[model samples]
Target: MNTWRQTSPTGRALLVTVLLTGLTTFMFLPLLAVHLSSEGVPAGRVGFLVGLLAFCSQGFSLLCGLVVDRFGTRAVLASGFGLRIAGYALLGAGTASATAVAGIAAIGIGGSLLGLAVKTRLVAEDGVPARDMLALRSTFVNIGVIAGPALGALVYPLGFGWILAACILSHLLLAIRLTLRPA
Candidate 1:
Protein backbone atom coordinates (compact mmCIF):
# COMPACT_ATOMS: atom_id res chain seq x y z
CA MET A 1 0.00 0.00 0.00
CA ASN A 2 1.32 3.38 -0.96
CA THR A 3 1.06 5.96 1.78
CA TRP A 4 1.27 8.60 -0.89
CA ARG A 5 -2.06 7.49 -2.33
CA GLN A 6 -3.66 7.47 1.09
CA THR A 7 -2.47 10.95 2.00
CA SER A 8 -3.88 14.24 0.76
CA PRO A 9 -1.64 16.56 -1.24
CA THR A 10 -0.78 18.62 1.82
CA GLY A 11 -0.08 15.54 3.88
CA ARG A 12 2.18 14.21 1.19
CA ALA A 13 4.15 17.43 1.11
CA LEU A 14 4.41 17.71 4.86
CA LEU A 15 5.40 14.11 5.26
CA VAL A 16 8.12 14.38 2.66
CA THR A 17 9.37 17.47 4.41
CA VAL A 18 9.51 15.60 7.68
CA LEU A 19 11.42 12.74 6.10
CA LEU A 20 13.98 15.07 4.59
CA THR A 21 14.34 16.95 7.81
CA GLY A 22 15.08 13.73 9.58
CA LEU A 23 17.56 12.76 6.91
CA THR A 24 19.29 16.12 7.08
CA THR A 25 19.42 16.14 10.84
CA PHE A 26 20.64 12.60 11.41
CA MET A 27 23.13 12.76 8.57
CA PHE A 28 24.81 15.89 9.83
CA LEU A 29 24.63 15.10 13.51
CA PRO A 30 26.30 11.69 13.52
CA LEU A 31 29.17 12.82 11.33
CA LEU A 32 29.65 16.27 12.78
CA ALA A 33 32.01 15.18 15.53
CA VAL A 34 34.24 13.43 13.04
CA HIS A 35 34.19 16.44 10.75
CA LEU A 36 35.10 18.78 13.57
CA SER A 37 37.74 16.49 14.94
CA SER A 38 39.35 16.08 11.55
CA GLU A 39 39.63 19.82 11.43
CA GLY A 40 41.55 19.57 14.74
CA VAL A 41 38.81 20.64 17.11
CA PRO A 42 39.36 19.22 20.59
CA ALA A 43 37.07 16.44 21.78
CA GLY A 44 35.60 18.54 24.58
CA ARG A 45 34.77 21.38 22.23
CA VAL A 46 33.19 18.92 19.84
CA GLY A 47 30.93 17.62 22.59
CA PHE A 48 30.02 21.16 23.57
CA LEU A 49 29.23 22.10 19.99
CA VAL A 50 27.03 19.04 19.53
CA GLY A 51 25.30 19.71 22.83
CA LEU A 52 24.75 23.36 21.92
CA LEU A 53 23.21 22.36 18.61
CA ALA A 54 20.90 19.93 20.40
CA PHE A 55 19.90 22.61 22.86
CA CYS A 56 19.00 25.07 20.14
CA SER A 57 16.89 22.53 18.27
CA GLN A 58 15.12 21.07 21.32
CA GLY A 59 15.35 23.75 23.98
CA PHE A 60 13.96 26.64 21.95
CA SER A 61 10.78 24.94 20.69
CA LEU A 62 8.61 26.92 23.12
CA LEU A 63 10.05 30.17 21.80
CA CYS A 64 9.67 28.89 18.27
CA GLY A 65 6.03 28.15 18.98
CA LEU A 66 5.56 31.79 19.93
CA VAL A 67 7.33 32.89 16.76
CA VAL A 68 5.15 30.62 14.67
CA ASP A 69 2.08 32.12 16.28
CA ARG A 70 3.20 35.61 15.34
CA PHE A 71 4.48 34.89 11.82
CA GLY A 72 2.53 31.86 10.56
CA THR A 73 3.88 28.58 9.23
CA ARG A 74 4.75 29.50 5.66
CA ALA A 75 7.00 32.39 6.56
CA VAL A 76 8.60 30.64 9.49
CA LEU A 77 9.18 27.43 7.51
CA ALA A 78 10.87 29.32 4.70
CA SER A 79 12.98 31.38 7.08
CA GLY A 80 14.03 28.28 8.98
CA PHE A 81 15.07 26.52 5.80
CA GLY A 82 17.00 29.60 4.73
CA LEU A 83 18.88 29.61 8.01
CA ARG A 84 19.73 25.93 7.54
CA ILE A 85 21.03 26.54 4.05
CA ALA A 86 23.24 29.37 5.21
CA GLY A 87 24.34 27.44 8.24
CA TYR A 88 25.55 24.50 6.16
CA ALA A 89 27.30 26.83 3.80
CA LEU A 90 29.13 28.48 6.66
CA LEU A 91 30.01 25.15 8.27
CA GLY A 92 31.52 23.98 5.00
CA ALA A 93 33.27 27.16 3.89
CA GLY A 94 34.76 28.50 7.10
CA THR A 95 37.56 26.92 9.12
CA ALA A 96 37.37 29.10 12.19
CA SER A 97 35.94 27.63 15.39
CA ALA A 98 33.65 30.61 15.83
CA THR A 99 32.25 30.14 12.34
CA ALA A 100 31.60 26.47 12.99
CA VAL A 101 29.76 27.19 16.23
CA ALA A 102 27.65 29.85 14.56
CA GLY A 103 26.80 27.49 11.73
CA ILE A 104 25.81 24.70 14.09
CA ALA A 105 23.66 27.06 16.12
CA ALA A 106 21.92 28.37 13.02
CA ILE A 107 21.09 24.82 11.96
CA GLY A 108 19.62 24.16 15.40
CA ILE A 109 17.51 27.30 15.45
CA GLY A 110 16.26 26.57 11.97
CA GLY A 111 15.29 23.05 12.97
CA SER A 112 13.46 24.40 16.00
CA LEU A 113 11.45 26.84 13.95
CA LEU A 114 10.79 24.40 11.15
CA GLY A 115 9.70 21.56 13.43
CA LEU A 116 7.15 23.65 15.31
CA ALA A 117 5.76 25.15 12.14
CA VAL A 118 5.17 21.73 10.63
CA LYS A 119 3.43 20.51 13.75
CA THR A 120 1.31 23.63 13.81
CA ARG A 121 0.40 23.19 10.18
CA LEU A 122 -0.53 19.59 10.79
CA VAL A 123 -2.78 20.31 13.72
CA ALA A 124 -4.46 23.18 11.89
CA GLU A 125 -5.44 21.03 8.94
CA ASP A 126 -9.16 20.27 8.96
CA GLY A 127 -9.16 17.01 7.06
CA VAL A 128 -6.80 14.87 9.12
CA PRO A 129 -7.07 14.31 12.82
CA ALA A 130 -4.00 15.81 14.47
CA ARG A 131 -3.27 12.50 16.16
CA ASP A 132 -3.21 10.64 12.88
CA MET A 133 -1.10 13.30 11.22
CA LEU A 134 1.38 13.21 14.07
CA ALA A 135 1.54 9.43 14.07
CA LEU A 136 2.29 9.47 10.37
CA ARG A 137 4.85 12.15 11.03
CA SER A 138 6.56 9.90 13.54
CA THR A 139 6.64 7.12 10.98
CA PHE A 140 8.34 9.36 8.46
CA VAL A 141 10.85 10.42 11.08
CA ASN A 142 11.74 6.82 11.81
CA ILE A 143 12.32 6.21 8.13
CA GLY A 144 14.75 9.12 8.04
CA VAL A 145 16.47 7.89 11.15
CA ILE A 146 17.25 4.70 9.29
CA ALA A 147 18.06 6.21 5.91
CA GLY A 148 20.18 9.15 6.99
CA PRO A 149 22.93 7.08 8.48
CA ALA A 150 23.03 4.82 5.46
CA LEU A 151 23.31 7.77 3.11
CA GLY A 152 25.89 9.41 5.36
CA ALA A 153 28.02 6.27 5.46
CA LEU A 154 28.02 6.05 1.70
CA VAL A 155 28.87 9.74 1.17
CA TYR A 156 31.02 10.70 4.13
CA PRO A 157 34.08 9.15 2.58
CA LEU A 158 33.81 11.52 -0.35
CA GLY A 159 34.03 14.20 2.34
CA PHE A 160 31.86 15.62 5.07
CA GLY A 161 31.28 18.45 2.63
CA TRP A 162 29.12 16.12 0.60
CA ILE A 163 26.79 15.56 3.53
CA LEU A 164 26.63 19.28 4.14
CA ALA A 165 25.92 19.93 0.48
CA ALA A 166 23.16 17.33 0.48
CA CYS A 167 21.55 18.90 3.52
CA ILE A 168 21.67 22.36 1.93
CA LEU A 169 20.28 21.16 -1.37
CA SER A 170 17.58 19.02 0.24
CA HIS A 171 16.38 21.90 2.37
CA LEU A 172 16.50 24.23 -0.62
CA LEU A 173 14.45 21.83 -2.70
CA LEU A 174 11.92 21.29 0.09
CA ALA A 175 11.57 25.03 0.62
CA ILE A 176 10.90 25.46 -3.05
CA ARG A 177 8.46 22.59 -2.86
CA LEU A 178 6.39 24.13 -0.04
CA THR A 179 6.49 27.49 -1.76
CA LEU A 180 5.05 26.02 -4.90
CA ARG A 181 2.54 23.72 -3.20
CA PRO A 182 1.71 25.90 -0.18
CA ALA A 183 1.17 23.15 2.39
Candidate 2:
Protein backbone atom coordinates (compact mmCIF):
# COMPACT_ATOMS: atom_id res chain seq x y z
CA MET A 1 0.00 0.00 0.00
CA ASN A 2 2.14 2.82 -1.32
CA THR A 3 0.92 6.36 -1.92
CA TRP A 4 2.05 9.25 -4.11
CA ARG A 5 0.66 12.47 -5.54
CA GLN A 6 1.31 14.15 -8.88
CA THR A 7 2.50 17.30 -7.18
CA SER A 8 6.27 16.92 -7.50
CA PRO A 9 8.48 16.53 -10.52
CA THR A 10 8.82 12.76 -10.21
CA GLY A 11 5.16 12.57 -9.44
CA ARG A 12 4.49 14.60 -12.55
CA ALA A 13 6.54 12.13 -14.53
CA LEU A 14 4.49 9.34 -13.08
CA LEU A 15 1.31 11.05 -14.21
CA VAL A 16 2.78 11.48 -17.66
CA THR A 17 3.75 7.83 -17.77
CA VAL A 18 0.28 6.76 -16.76
CA LEU A 19 -1.24 9.12 -19.30
CA LEU A 20 1.08 7.75 -21.97
CA THR A 21 0.00 4.21 -21.22
CA GLY A 22 -3.66 5.10 -21.06
CA LEU A 23 -3.41 7.20 -24.18
CA THR A 24 -1.59 4.40 -25.96
CA THR A 25 -4.45 2.00 -25.39
CA PHE A 26 -7.14 4.61 -25.87
CA MET A 27 -5.51 5.75 -29.06
CA PHE A 28 -5.47 2.22 -30.37
CA LEU A 29 -8.95 0.98 -29.52
CA PRO A 30 -10.95 2.86 -32.14
CA LEU A 31 -8.05 2.93 -34.53
CA LEU A 32 -7.99 -0.81 -34.44
CA ALA A 33 -11.69 -0.88 -35.18
CA VAL A 34 -11.27 1.54 -38.04
CA HIS A 35 -8.17 -0.14 -39.36
CA LEU A 36 -9.88 -3.49 -39.37
CA SER A 37 -13.04 -1.98 -40.79
CA SER A 38 -11.16 -0.63 -43.78
CA GLU A 39 -9.28 -3.88 -44.24
CA GLY A 40 -12.53 -5.83 -44.28
CA VAL A 41 -11.32 -7.91 -41.36
CA PRO A 42 -14.94 -8.84 -40.67
CA ALA A 43 -16.90 -7.23 -37.85
CA GLY A 44 -16.72 -10.41 -35.82
CA ARG A 45 -12.92 -10.42 -35.88
CA VAL A 46 -12.78 -6.86 -34.59
CA GLY A 47 -13.56 -7.90 -31.04
CA PHE A 48 -11.10 -10.72 -31.30
CA LEU A 49 -8.28 -8.41 -32.40
CA VAL A 50 -8.91 -5.95 -29.61
CA GLY A 51 -9.09 -8.81 -27.13
CA LEU A 52 -5.81 -10.18 -28.40
CA LEU A 53 -4.12 -6.84 -27.90
CA ALA A 54 -5.41 -6.51 -24.33
CA PHE A 55 -4.45 -10.06 -23.52
CA CYS A 56 -0.91 -9.62 -24.79
CA SER A 57 -0.45 -6.27 -23.04
CA GLN A 58 -1.71 -7.67 -19.79
CA GLY A 59 0.60 -10.65 -20.13
CA PHE A 60 3.57 -8.38 -20.62
CA SER A 61 2.79 -6.64 -17.33
CA LEU A 62 3.12 -9.94 -15.53
CA LEU A 63 6.81 -10.24 -16.47
CA CYS A 64 7.75 -6.56 -16.35
CA GLY A 65 8.99 -6.55 -12.74
CA LEU A 66 11.66 -9.09 -13.58
CA VAL A 67 12.60 -7.34 -16.81
CA VAL A 68 12.97 -4.00 -15.07
CA ASP A 69 15.19 -5.52 -12.41
CA ARG A 70 17.56 -6.95 -14.99
CA PHE A 71 17.69 -4.01 -17.39
CA GLY A 72 17.47 -0.91 -15.17
CA THR A 73 14.71 1.70 -15.45
CA ARG A 74 16.54 3.97 -17.89
CA ALA A 75 16.94 1.29 -20.52
CA VAL A 76 13.49 -0.07 -19.95
CA LEU A 77 11.89 3.37 -20.15
CA ALA A 78 13.79 4.32 -23.28
CA SER A 79 12.90 1.04 -24.90
CA GLY A 80 9.29 1.58 -23.91
CA PHE A 81 9.29 4.89 -25.72
CA GLY A 82 10.94 3.36 -28.77
CA LEU A 83 8.52 0.46 -28.78
CA ARG A 84 5.54 2.79 -28.67
CA ILE A 85 6.89 4.70 -31.63
CA ALA A 86 7.53 1.55 -33.60
CA GLY A 87 4.26 -0.04 -32.52
CA TYR A 88 2.19 2.89 -33.70
CA ALA A 89 3.96 2.95 -37.04
CA LEU A 90 3.52 -0.76 -37.53
CA LEU A 91 -0.13 -0.53 -36.52
CA GLY A 92 -0.80 2.34 -38.89
CA ALA A 93 0.87 0.50 -41.73
CA GLY A 94 -0.97 -2.65 -40.75
CA THR A 95 -3.83 -1.35 -42.83
CA ALA A 96 -2.52 -3.70 -45.50
CA SER A 97 -0.65 -6.27 -43.46
CA ALA A 98 -0.69 -8.48 -40.33
CA THR A 99 1.89 -6.28 -38.68
CA ALA A 100 -0.85 -4.26 -36.99
CA VAL A 101 -1.44 -7.16 -34.67
CA ALA A 102 2.26 -7.29 -33.97
CA GLY A 103 2.24 -3.56 -33.39
CA ILE A 104 -0.44 -3.93 -30.76
CA ALA A 105 1.60 -6.61 -29.03
CA ALA A 106 4.67 -4.42 -29.11
CA ILE A 107 2.75 -1.53 -27.58
CA GLY A 108 1.42 -3.84 -24.93
CA ILE A 109 4.89 -5.12 -24.17
CA GLY A 110 6.33 -1.63 -23.99
CA GLY A 111 3.49 -0.52 -21.77
CA SER A 112 4.14 -3.27 -19.27
CA LEU A 113 7.76 -2.28 -19.08
CA LEU A 114 6.91 1.37 -18.73
CA GLY A 115 4.45 0.62 -15.99
CA LEU A 116 6.99 -1.27 -13.93
CA ALA A 117 9.83 1.09 -14.71
CA VAL A 118 7.87 4.09 -13.49
CA LYS A 119 7.00 2.35 -10.25
CA THR A 120 10.58 1.35 -9.67
CA ARG A 121 11.84 4.82 -10.47
CA LEU A 122 9.38 6.40 -8.09
CA VAL A 123 10.36 4.10 -5.25
CA ALA A 124 14.01 4.64 -5.96
CA GLU A 125 13.47 8.38 -5.88
CA ASP A 126 11.53 8.31 -2.62
CA GLY A 127 8.48 9.81 -4.28
CA VAL A 128 6.10 8.69 -1.55
CA PRO A 129 5.30 6.32 1.26
CA ALA A 130 5.90 2.70 0.33
CA ARG A 131 2.58 1.75 1.85
CA ASP A 132 0.52 3.88 -0.49
CA MET A 133 2.52 4.23 -3.70
CA LEU A 134 0.79 1.46 -5.57
CA ALA A 135 -2.61 3.00 -4.93
CA LEU A 136 -1.45 6.41 -6.05
CA ARG A 137 0.18 4.89 -9.09
CA SER A 138 -3.02 3.10 -9.96
CA THR A 139 -5.01 6.25 -9.44
CA PHE A 140 -3.02 8.08 -12.08
CA VAL A 141 -3.24 5.07 -14.33
CA ASN A 142 -6.99 5.02 -13.99
CA ILE A 143 -7.13 8.68 -14.82
CA GLY A 144 -5.49 7.80 -18.09
CA VAL A 145 -7.95 4.97 -18.53
CA ILE A 146 -10.86 7.32 -18.07
CA ALA A 147 -9.42 9.86 -20.45
CA GLY A 148 -8.33 7.38 -23.11
CA PRO A 149 -11.79 6.13 -24.03
CA ALA A 150 -13.06 9.64 -24.50
CA LEU A 151 -10.02 10.53 -26.53
CA GLY A 152 -10.52 7.50 -28.73
CA ALA A 153 -14.17 8.34 -29.23
CA LEU A 154 -13.22 11.84 -30.26
CA VAL A 155 -10.38 10.80 -32.56
CA TYR A 156 -11.80 7.57 -33.96
CA PRO A 157 -14.09 9.55 -36.24
CA LEU A 158 -11.25 11.41 -37.79
CA GLY A 159 -8.50 8.78 -38.29
CA PHE A 160 -6.58 6.23 -36.26
CA GLY A 161 -3.22 7.31 -37.60
CA TRP A 162 -3.52 10.69 -35.96
CA ILE A 163 -4.09 9.10 -32.60
CA LEU A 164 -1.04 6.96 -33.10
CA ALA A 165 0.90 10.04 -34.15
CA ALA A 166 -0.19 11.81 -30.97
CA CYS A 167 1.03 8.87 -28.95
CA ILE A 168 4.40 9.12 -30.71
CA LEU A 169 4.65 12.75 -29.71
CA SER A 170 3.85 11.86 -26.12
CA HIS A 171 6.66 9.35 -26.08
CA LEU A 172 9.04 11.81 -27.69
CA LEU A 173 8.19 14.35 -25.01
CA LEU A 174 8.95 11.85 -22.28
CA ALA A 175 12.20 10.89 -23.98
CA ILE A 176 13.30 14.48 -24.30
CA ARG A 177 12.44 15.21 -20.68
CA LEU A 178 14.37 12.17 -19.56
CA THR A 179 17.37 13.19 -21.65
CA LEU A 180 17.47 16.75 -20.37
CA ARG A 181 16.94 15.87 -16.73
CA PRO A 182 20.04 15.04 -14.75
CA ALA A 183 20.42 11.36 -14.28
Best by lDDT: 1
TM-score of each: 0.93, 0.83
Deviation from truth (RMSD, Å), model 1: 1.7
Candidate 1: segments with Cα more than 4 A from true spot:
1-6, 180-183
1-183: candidate 2 lDDT, tens digit per residue: 224333467566766677676766765665677678787878767776777778877888888888888988888888887887788778777644478677877777877777788878766655456546666667777877778888877876777777888888788788777645765
Candidates in order have lDDT scores of 0.86, 0.73
Superposition error at 137 for model 1 (Å): 0.3
Prediction 2 TM-score vs. true: 0.83
